[model samples]
Target: MKVIAINGSPRKDWNTATMLRHALQGSADRGAFTELIHLYELDYRGCSSCFACKTLGSPSYGRCAQQDDLAPVLRRIEEAGALILGSPIYFGQVTGEMRSFLERLLFPYLRYSREKRSLFPRKMDTAWIYTMNCPEAAIKDAGYDRVFAENERLLKMIFGGSCFTLTSHETLQFADYGKVDADMFDPAGRKARHEQVFPRDCERAYELGARLAQNISRGLPS
Candidate 1:
């Protein structure tokens, strides 16, 4: 089984990256081949809304027509058994990198794999990772939940599979120079969230990967 993680945070090795690293680590421990693609290192653009992909008899499935960094990433996503996307909340929404990458991902699914195949590919699963300064108890109070929920809704409509969200509170405070405290920080801030939220939100990603590996091995589940 192959698990692909797209870390969309510009701060590639920070809060969001750290969490996804653990999540992907879990996938690795489960015997799944895993990779983390940091968006900051890639060169790509958001969907340009070109209809060229929808032209009749297109040969490219799961590929964006735009010749940029996204094409290679899309190929990896299609080949992977599981997907875990991580983003840092910026101004109550995902970062520009994440948003743009999301557009690239959605455009294909929205267009029905460029008329070549279905978006979900029969048994693939996706998970979303969010790390922000907002505390868990105050997620709704911060009003970011609405924005994220809307994004999730759109994702579900487009992908049609189990999607999970993992959010971290006081993420900014978690680090000094990109290194979180070893211990003895304010427990009230994000302790409950950290302890309670192990990999529950990302378990589906692994399960989905395993299920997908099984399905692909069984020839697309009939």
Candidate 2:
């Protein structure tokens, strides 16, 4: 069995990547082949808005017809038992690349006919992890709850799978507080929160991964 973690952060070694790695490591510990795909390392674009996948009797049904770096990754996801998508919130939503990836990944599976169902029939479990500088109390300030809920709904609808979500709030923003302008953020507060909560978040991510693998192995919802 395979489980893939897609990291949509520009900084491969940043908090977002670290959290994803922890999750992947957990999947690995559970005996699933785990791989990490970093979007910043790839050259790709969002969906092209082509109707090829939607064309009647199209061979590309349920698959992205676009020729890009993400195509193969999509195939891998289609074959995998579990998926973990991690991103640092950018301007109140997932980063542009992550959003673009989602557009390509999900749009093709949408069917318009009566009894519409995703063309991809495989059962896969998914987890979405989001990291942000804002505290949990401010999560609604950006209105991400709606977005997260919608995406979770779509993942289940399209893949006939279960989905889980993790959010790491008040993430560490700056590595060196002394060199940067500290007026805009409370470095001390961030430090305290990070020291107290980030590790626990990582543990949760690890548990999520292991549980997803276990559930997928048993052909059950995660």
Candidate 3:
């Protein structure tokens, strides 16, 4: 089985990327072919509201019509047995790049009819890994939990498979806070949590990936 992880953070070596790497490592260790894609490295636009994907008798039906860097990535995902998406929360939601990526990835397969919900070719497990500077206790108050749940719900509906979410909270945002004028956060506390809590979060991500691979191998639902 092949497991693919998409990193939606601009910084390739930051928290989101690190968690995704750990997840991919776990998948690879479980005898699954694994690949990691960085969305920022690809030049792509969000869906253009083109109805080609939904138009009857169209060749592009059930597929994204735009041809760009994301085209091949989406095709690769079509072949994957499992997928993981990782992003850092910005302004109470995922980054702009991730939002655009989701638009391109999900819109094509979404059916307008009530009888059928998705046009995706097969059933596959999916997971979302989120890193945020906000504390876990504040997630509900901030309404970020709804965002996460909505994403999971959409993935489950579109792919016809189980979907789960993992979140890393109070993430370290900078290597040296003194270099910037961000006085709203305590740099020392964030560093301490990164050293203590973030490692545990990475371990959780790894376990999530390993479990996904194991389930696929065993013909079990994730």
The root-mean-square deviation over C-alpha atoms between each candidate and the true structure, in angstroms, is 5.3, 1.3, 0.8
Model 1, residue 82: C-alpha shift (Å): 1.1
**Candidate 1: global Cα-lDDT?**
0.69
Candidate 1: segments with Cα more than 4 A from true spot: 112-120, 173-222
Candidate 1: worst 10 consecutive residues by lDDT? 213-222
Q: Candidate 2 has which clashing residue pairs, if any? A: none
lDDT of 1 by residue, 131-199 (tens): 776667888888988887887776666656556666766654453432654465555545454445534
Name the 10 consecutive residues with the lowest summed lDDT in model 2: 133-142
Error of 3 at 169 (Å): 0.8
Cα lDDT tens digits, model 3, 4-99, are 999999999999999999998889889999999999999999999988999999999999989999999999999898999999998988899999
Q: Choose 2 or 3, whichever is better by TM-score.
A: 3
On the 0 to 100 scale, the lDDT of residue 123 in model 2 is: 76
lDDT of 3 at 197: 97
Predicted structure 1: clash tally: 0
TM-score of decoy 2:
0.95
Winning model by lDDT: 3
CA displacement after TM-score superposition, residue 26 of candidate 2 (Å): 1.3
TM-score of each: 0.75, 0.95, 0.98
